[model samples]
Target: MTLFWAGAYALTRVAVDKGNPDMGLPVAWVLPGRLTIGAAVLWVLMLARGQKLPPLRDRKRWVAIIGMGLAGSVFPFFLITTAQETVNSSLAA
Candidate 1:
């Protein structure tokens, strides 16, 4: 898991580096693309394993879901990807 995350940061740095020829991906494109793909893949796996989502009508559940989504995944991803733009991936990771 540590290596995987490290590699992810390295790849992110490469992708987000605008000066790299034919390899540079826009910073704007990185976060959304990564998050969406990650989310889709996780959903597919969860469905395959027959894991059901929690009840949507539960207010407490929704709050926790939204909080985790923003704080746990989205915020961290955004910070790291953004950081890679101006800093080395190894340091950013």
Candidate 2:
């Protein structure tokens, strides 16, 4: 999780830097690509280590994942990445 978070931070930093402050590029393209790449890497790591994720058998857990993915991951990632284009890392953080 620590490493993944670090990767996320680095990714956002790079994305903001590359696109510049105006953010004229497509965030729809940007956000999903970053997420897909991260997800693929995580999936590969799990497979390589013979690790299994928890089954989404419970409604609460399912809700939690969805909520967190949207609220915590996607939303904040977009907001911070976009904001970082105009703001410093300290201010964004």
Q: Which candidate leads the pack in TM-score?
A: 1
Model 2 TM-score, 2 decimals: 0.61
Q: Per-residue lDDT of 1-93 in model 2, one digit per residue for the tens?
A: 777666665656666674454654455667888889879998999999999877878888888888989997899878877776666655665
Candidate lDDT scores, in order, read 0.83, 0.73
Candidate 1 deviant stretches above 4 angstroms: 18-23
Lowest-scoring 10 consecutive residues by lDDT in candidate 1? Answer: 18-27
> Cα deviation of 72 in candidate 1 (Å)?
0.9
Rate residue 63 of model 1 by lDDT. 95
Per-residue lDDT value at 2 in model 1: 85
Off by over 4 Å in 2: 1-14, 17-24, 53-59
Tens digits of per-residue lDDT for model 1, 18-93:
3563567776798889888889999999999999888888889899989999999888888888777778877887
